[model samples]
Target: MHAHRKTRPPANLGPWQRLLLLWLLGPLLWLQARHVRRITPRMPEPPGQRAGSAGQGSLIRLLVAGDSGAAGVGAPTQEQALCGQLVRRLSRHHRVEWCVLAVNGLDSPGLHQLLLDTPEAAFDVVVLSMGANDATALCAPLQWACWQSRLADLIALRFAPALLMHSAVPPMHACLALPQPLRWFMGRWAQQMNLSLAALLIEKVGRSMHWHPSTTTTAGMAADGFHPSAAGYALWAEGLSQHILAAQIASRHHPDLKPCSAAAIAH
Candidate 1:
């Protein structure tokens, strides 16, 4: 017996409705991307220290990635750079094999692409210091966000450190001695970029992410008058060291860890 069935309403919406949906969803998708990016670390955490007997120690490997500041462009030697100082500090508590995968003049986008081109390997901890160059370029927020998203994807897929720390853009205004327009624009752009980065990171990673304030500057004009000198890197490293130590403290206190061996930790 064939019965007559009632036709249902059209499942598809009108053009206006579709357009409205797209308009509303565009911003939402951007925000969602930022959130997704935050949860994933761009690089692997320093390797977890394997526990030995009660009084034995553990070893860790750290991967540092970023731009000139991260690369310590003005530092005379590797030991004087940001990465070197960081390893020196962390070595006080754990056996550290620190490797820096950094470059000079890289913006957020460049760093993201570099990670894409790298081999997939895990590290114990990852420190990312990017966006300074991007600030100088005066990139739009959306563009920066796009690079950040790519970075997040790389971290999610390959290297996710047990802990990830992102440093804040340092004050370019310390170069305020320059003429009005250049100084004004550079300082304003940097401030905006920092603000955007901080907000996005906090929203996504919550407390899992740490922020290092790069307050050091060459108000007196270092050699280049652009990059920070050894003293400037020193101040930057000092601030970063404090945060890394805090993260390490939690790892050390974890029940799975054995007593830290002084010799191993100091290495």
Candidate 2:
């Protein structure tokens, strides 16, 4: 019998066009980025328990990982953060053991290192909230895709979750905090990065992972205008919880179907 091969999605024209656009407008974008940074407030991560249990039934170990959003910077406490909301939704029918591995400013590379540094653990489900920092930093979509793949591989090797859920980068083009061309640049980059991520997931079709694109608009966010509000977290969490439950109900054994199958269609 011959083994099958999975080819990488091409280094298509989308990323190159974005790169060209960035290069042409680099100077203007840089100034805007600097100004935004100078004026933007640096909010601390919300205080809350990093680990806990919720509801009752068979065990569903959960891990939420990523940067500021994952750390729930906009919310008042950990209970109102993404992890808390996710647990609150998922716990209704199953006992959930959850822990949060997130920080305030970590990007994809930072997240990869964080996971590398943590001790081995097992999880049935893992939620990842990332890419805002990467988007803000203006990382290229192709590079972003590669880093995401590495991080996904790291997560698989370290935690071995039955399901890996990747939270969307959010719609930065509509963020209230940013101004002008900077916002425009970030928005374009963010969309490209998301497309790259969605493509990456498609490449890993055999894996039990899915991308959870933002369901709500960025207009309903927190003080930062980027990180989700408490209510926003609940909304996002509810959406994610539904997807997880649907996947589980379809096959309790493991998440089936090509990764991001729905996300590809939705995007």
Candidate 3:
């Protein structure tokens, strides 16, 4: 009897294979995007104050900026969204003067442009939530890297936040609203862009920027099934609060360490 051999599929496609696959599936992907857009109701940014102060005594200036999630699209108001949750969580320890500058449909380049137009200001922390829109737009990994690098540079130069927290790109594969093939493709692209972002931040900003992982779930998604529901925002806010608090403790212990400098914290 002849011995049977088991074969495993390759983990990833070659550049040529990817190109060919894209070419073949381009029309279908386009149609899927159109269909999604047509069916999904347009969600406005949740209404709330863009700037507010919380707690008292010593000030911890914070800036939250980026895309729809950061703008609190799914939640009823800003208070139920990322900014409100984050501010509330952080306010437990220090007086928080938080400002949000997020816009729906904004990408990395748009964020950079927004920052360029805003007046220079110092912030103890700047939490950036982005990459989903960039992934949906099919931004190239290299381009993503460039835009991220530029954004980091601008933040460091202008805002000079002691800690720059970059919220991880959400899991597109887990987005229940997105259909197959399109979801698979976007998920892969998002992962690539995230990898590129991590590498770029490590190389350029070092310990200044902390890459945070997303802990969202399908059940925690909003009515649109695209944005984060209130529960999802709470989970995200908890993660950010922990990171900020840990950084604060570390800063207190190391008096000589500069928050935005390479020596501030370990990756």
Candidate 4:
């Protein structure tokens, strides 16, 4: 019997092959970087609240930042967006002035840059909804982590007294589910990235941070099936309310603010 020998592909690669390999590996590595950065939460600034005209002590000035979801892209109108609904709901108790600094496709880095570049007088509460766009960027996990760390540093240095709230990483795979191949890759990537973000939130902010586990309903999906609809914004508002109430009650010892979850509202 003749001995069988396996042949290796090659020690050296052609231009096209090398380019193809780089193309494939680049995204993979980039996505890994996103994962690592997102897993751990960063310590950013407390919201800076401008005194509301209603009376400085009586009002809550909230600042919201993020991508399309935070911008309420899928909603029918701007008034129905996240900031709108949140302001509306929060205003019931205290006068509210919500300043939304967000665009359609901003990720963590974009959000940070936006904050750094944009100048606002003050804010009492700050809410962050991002990371989906970062996943879209396909940045590597470690690189992404570095950015998150830098963001945290920036926040700590700049903002003060104002409360900081971060929404849990949304399920991006749901957005990609229609396209099978893309769905598999995006879903896995999103899962890993969300995990990274969760870890960070725990490590950096601890219990002080709020995480909104999205149970986004398809009916609440935007016409494009990507962004959240009005109903979806409602869900987000509900989640946020829980955190807000929890903190308010904890800080002021207000019995009314004790229960903040949707389940509490449902009852």
Candidate 5:
């Protein structure tokens, strides 16, 4: 997911530390995975316009990108999802232009490729909602960090957004659909994945990015209990808005945003 699409991938962190221990419960977990898949309701991306303009004042362009979370799966409308809530709040004092480019099950690599294909556009702020799909897909934490670093660089070169925010992974340990050991395992992996991502942002892409979500979302907060609901989106949006407001993006201090070509930026 870096300048190395034609080169070798990053080193695996070896198996999860508990992988061997969990192997003993393999058969049970296997069946549980299938059973959960069968019973879990398939959620459709909630409906509403994916692009719009709102509020009045200084123009602040925004883009919300990632997996189904960015696509608004649980909420009935985009207006109630992350993008909608974020726009509603930001629009109060700034003219907000927003768009969402996300799919139901996209992981880091998919988003990377998708962004490369998207026409370049400048944005004042960009909020990312991802990691759950990658964690569930068993993507190694180091590899995820590698891809995510490249993603950050791509966003800088492509969109040149002054503020790049990453929302924390949703709480999967409390997902009602997953069972016992499987849930525990997934939850642990997600925690590790989040930690690795945070490290990458601070140590590598720290330029002008924010890695924290305002609140910790617990279980069963969404329509399907696997995705966030309206209230959940509102909480997340509040945190993001606060950070953006505090940054006072209208002023020039975030040199992190650059419109240089991909090769010119460090991944």
Candidate 6:
């Protein structure tokens, strides 16, 4: 589903204020990171088959790409993560052949570079789970916007999926693993980045691009309180399936339209 835009200004600190804030908050941020590391053991991305086909219908080529969340880190296997969940849901209507291209800590620009390096392949749908790492790395909103725009351009130039779905930045403020000001800070940054991303998508890809908000709750968090639990992945997949179905309906009505083309989305 498309996200409504808010007209608030960016939340980044002014130059001098940023310097002062960093000088004061840097030590605390470091401490919080260390404390979180001590409490939350690193979890490997779920292992198992990444490619599979199911159901009997028109073939749907799907690509799930991004970071740890996309890699299904919290779940025991890919079958329990977002990719598997999505494939299962979509397979009810379409024979889905899905592949996942993700890593543990990839940011927006990193994902874009990876897509560029990979060989081109057409996909019926593309789902991206990103931005949390970017927020953690303190990527500036302007920088994130630029990278997101470039990523959109690359997608248009390359995969050109009928629908492109972007998972919204997670609710970092609600993360139990993060310490006070650090969580607060990352949350604000994530909000800013998400806003920038939404605007860019609306401008560039329009209706062909869908934004799915975080459906995760406190109880849906994994042991680390950072990644999503299996329940959270199910919720995410359910929402995504709805949007994909909508896009499929729209495409059916406009058969001549090139899905995800700049001109098509601009309208």
Segments of candidate 6 deviating more than 4 angstroms = 1-23, 206-218, 249-267
> Candidate 6's error at 196, in angstroms?
0.9
lDDT of 2 by residue, 90-129 (tens): 8998888788888999999888888887766667787888
Error of 3 at 84 (Å): 0.4
Q: Predict model 4's lDDT versus the native.
A: 0.55
Kindly give the number of clashing pairs for every candidate: 13, 0, 0, 27, 0, 0
**Residue 196 displacement (Å), model 2:** 1.2
Question: Candidate 5 at residue 110, lDDT?
Answer: 91
Error of 4 at 78 (Å): 2.1
Q: Which ten residues in a row have the lowest lDDT in candidate 2?
A: 1-10
lDDT of each: 0.56, 0.73, 0.73, 0.55, 0.71, 0.72
Give a tens-digit lDDT track for model 4, residues 1-267.
Answer: 001222111133333543465477666655654654565333222232212222123556566667777777777665677777776677666666556666777778777887677542344566777776776565644455566666656554444324677665565545522343344354455555555555666655422444444344566666555567677787788778667755662112223223112221110
**Model 1 agreement with the true structure over 6-49: per-residue lDDT tens digits:** 21211333335534654765465445435534653232122222
| Candidate 3 off by > 4 Å | 1-18, 203-218, 249-267
Query: Against the true structure, what is each candidate's TM-score?
Result: 0.65, 0.83, 0.83, 0.66, 0.82, 0.82
| Model 6 lDDT at residue 195 | 72
Instruction: Return whichever of 4 and 6 wins on lDDT.
Output: 6
Q: Could you tell me the TM-score of candidate 5?
A: 0.82
After TM-score superposition, the amount by which residue 173's alpha carbon in candidate 5 deviates from its true location, in angstroms, is: 1.3
What is the C-alpha lDDT profile of model 5 across 12-113, one tens digit per residue? 233655477457777887788888778888889888888878999888877889998889888889999889999999999898878888889999989999
Q: Give the per-residue lDDT digits (tens) of candidate 3, residues 32-137.
A: 9899989988889988787877886566877788999889888889899998999898888888877888889999999999888876665778888888888888
